[model samples]
Target: MRTHRKVLVLFAALASALAGCSSGPNQPDTVAGQFADALNRDDIAAAAALTDDPTRAADSLNGLYDGLGKEVTFEVGSADRNSFTLAATWNLGPDGKNKWSYTTTGTANDTGDGWKVKWEPAAIAPGLDIGPLTYDPVYPKPARILDASGGELMTQQVVTLVNVSQGADTAAVAALIAPLAPGLSAQSLESDLAAAQGKPITAISLRAADIAPVQAALETTRGVTLAPQTRLLANDKSLASPTLSGLDDLWQKSTAAATGWAVRVPIPDGTKRLAGQDAQPTPDIATTLSIDLQHAAEDALTPIAEPAAIVALQPSTGNVLAVAQNAAADAQGPIALTGLYPPGSTFKTVTVSAALQEGSVTPDTVLPCPGVANIEGRRIPNDDNFDLGQVPLHTAFARSCNTTMGGLAVKLPADALTNAATQLGLGIDYVTPGLTTVTGKVPPAATPAQRVESGIGQGQVTASPFGMALVAASLARGSVPAPALVKEQPGVADKTPEPLPPNVDDQVKSMMRETVTGGTATSLRDIPGLLGKTGTAEYIDDKHAHGWFVGVDGDLAFAVFISDAGSSGPAVEAAGRMLRMQR
Candidate 1:
């Protein structure tokens, strides 16, 4: 028994000695854990203290963190008495989509009083060489914005960049160039040239097509140098510039550092796009625009010096055929599809539909048409307050009798216009990947006057040119055809079509045709099968009105608009021009 007790005592002593050797105040794993915590917390001084070359390693870690960008987290993956590995993940702010993750491993050894990392470049990045590193971001060729006919609406085009070097006359150079590109300001060019650094003077970048009209004159101009550069853009004076500008933003966002981040390599030329090059692969998204119709719509707005927009749609398919906006309207951000404005008397189509459904009026039903009628004590007047005493509903609509329409509003519910507008594909709830639109707005009325106003396409009744075109399309097709700009399988059409009252479509069609024959829209008489409504919508203040024309001609249905046009004459003229061009 005494011998067994002695053996037990000896084993306990050996176990204690082994435990002592295995752990200490400066053990490898403990040191590594502290280092990782310090690194993660950005405690440069504390982390440096744990390394052999304190200052150098801390500086290295600082550079590493700086390269990692905004957010980064660190963890000690594996640790032991002699070795440890750390895993780190970094996010380069919102500007970068991808996160970078890498693991760093290093050895640890006892140095008299404590354990320290055998610091080396590999401990920061595996196989990292001598010297600082730089990140070079690479950009891909912007994708082409194509139309339904597979025609490129916005494509890669060459442009000329004019530069004024040392001792050059900025005014003379700008004067020569301004005639070629009207948007370019000679005074601004002179100012820019005066403030230029390495490059003497930089002028506006002119599209090759824009400069072609006066290439002869530009060649003869003095004190300037021109260089050809390539970029994605629309044709000169095209309405697709806003769309292209949006695409350019996407391209900028898609850019990132190239793979296998290097210390030294020749950077690639950004304009060597994969679009036309066989050496690389990229994307080109297809949309449902029509280049031919888009140009026709642009030509239609040529005569209107004010801000104007025109949109065209295929009635059977609801595909957007064209979206064109005059230069004066471009600042409004693709107003053809996104601008919201009161529809004015053009909204009577919806009001009539509601009235027919509610059994309040019919084509044969005769209604009041005084020069001015009072609805709920609010006075309502027709266009120029022209009275057509006691006319049929059909004749009243054909003549755009606002006073007569106002009478029907007093008989219907507040949501009547809202429901009718929704049923007609206005204010449709939908989302397209790379498209924008404002369907329409028909808010419920709080007062009889408001309801009467809504009846005449005023008050809360609003629409974009795109939205008005859809309403015209729905009336022409006898059902609400879904509108789409992208090739979507079960897209806008999948939305429930608003049921129209029986023969209501036919009645409205007849009245619209009558509008061209002997009504307010008589300007469209020369356009065969042209059935339409003309509106001069009052907006902003008393005298400011917007011109609106919505119509259907054969397979086409469209809307034209001109801001502050006072009357629909300009819109009608633009519509006529579009029809003639399309024909």
Candidate 2:
């Protein structure tokens, strides 16, 4: 009876062990059913809470559903106390027609009361299909605006090296590297390399080791390499140090205009700062300048071998039309708008206007012109070195008689002349797009001689072709529009222009018309409806004269000035060419 009791006790212990092993339901659906119910109702939060590692399970489900082309269903393949396996079928979309199958395995840990599923996808199944795989493209950035209308223009750029080797002779290496790095400053490059290495690199000699990491990084990240012998040093071998110096000098002048525009650059990943980097590349500016017209203007005036300036603008819109300065032969600096010279006889228009506005004289007023006129103990002569006996104000202007203009200058108070010049946009800084402009001085109030000369477009009086063109433009539109390089912006487009009184503009227009018709600028007769004025301003030494001509057609206004060149003949010729081109 005792032996029977021992067998029964041993059997009972064995039964208890087996029961613990098989304690979980035969079907793993118990937990899976709850997870499926939550998923079927689109309750991600509930489904996530039911698992031991809900966060991981939820993330996996999110990734899977995100990539699924359709809806899906789950099935239990097998189950045990510690683990379970599931098979799933998904419909690509809401239609639930297209389907895909994936097999997943899950493991459960014994909780105090029951089994709780661990949320590891890898542990579940080897061939589980989470979803389609995707990766970022190698070249994922936007393309840059390379060129406008496919024409070569001046541009700037910064240069740098990746995975370059550092050596003791870094400075020497940089010197050798200068020519290969176009638009990059060697000093700047050295500074950057020094900072990158966390110490001063007096010299750099790159070898295979220094480049390995950079090469590896690029290859791994960008899937590309620096091509063999693609280095710039070999191509620039023939360039001498002096040549580099000359290039540096030119860059300074060209970059001066860069202050007028904004620059854009791409920020690559892992780039911390641009500090100490090589000088950035300079971008080319697309200007309103007409290269063909500029070349022609240069050719036409250079033959006379004189300093000159010319500017053309649309009368109605104030768009700069064309400009030419000193001849190409004598090419100095950019002469388009910065050249300053005396206005000479051209200033008579300003004097005459002042006189009319001050009620000192009118177009029909008679003025004494007996060969010469004495004013403030000085004799002022006409262009012929003498003046006509007595002539109407208009006739005096037409003949460009200096004596009459000098007499009128004395009669008109200095303030009147100053006000007229100021109203016409002179004696003030003039800023324009993509170009530098000279203010062109006018005589100050303190000096009588300066004021007299200023009245006659001499002495301290100076003006650019750009300013003169603006004067003509004022006459054309009964106002002046601010000159611009880019298209005018909205809201403030018309504000740039300053208006003149209607009567004043009309009188100037009539006089300008007479000038081209039969007066000083008869050369412009071929240009129908053209109105213009010519000036032959004399310098103190009388060695050379500055020639000027300003004119206007329907909606275009232009001015030309030739420096140290006698007479306005060449300027007139150039103006005619420009006018024809415009037509």
Tens-digit per-residue lDDT, 1-583, candidate 1 = 1121111111232234334445766766666667766666667689888988898887877776565443556666555447667676554334544455678887778887588877776665543434333333334555676767776666667888776676566566666677766666766765666677546665667787667765666566666677788776764444653345544544333332222222221234422211111212346656677777878888888777899999888888877777788888987678877888999878888888888889767788988899998788878887778989989998999899989888898678988888888777787755544456677888888788889889988887889888899899989998887666655622443357559867888888898899899898887788777899988899887589999999999778999989999988899999988888877
TM-score of each: 0.78, 0.52
Give the top-scoring candidate (TM-score): 1
Each model's lDDT comes to 0.73, 0.57
Candidate 1: regions farther than 4 A off: 1-24, 43-49, 54-63, 77-81, 91-104, 111-114, 130-142, 156-232, 235-237, 241-283, 489-497, 540-542
| lDDT string, candidate 2, 1-583, tens digits | 1121111011233233335555445323456556655665556677677777678767766754554421445554455455556666544333443334567777656565555666665533232233222111111111111112323322232222333333333444444544545544546655666676854332322234344534454334321223332111211222111112222343454443222211111234522221111233454333343444445554555555566666777667766545555534136565556667788877777788778888767788898876766677665666667647887888777767777877777766657676676656555455444445563666553555555666778777788777788777767777656665434511122123234545887787787788887778887798899988888888866667877888888887778777666787888887887667655
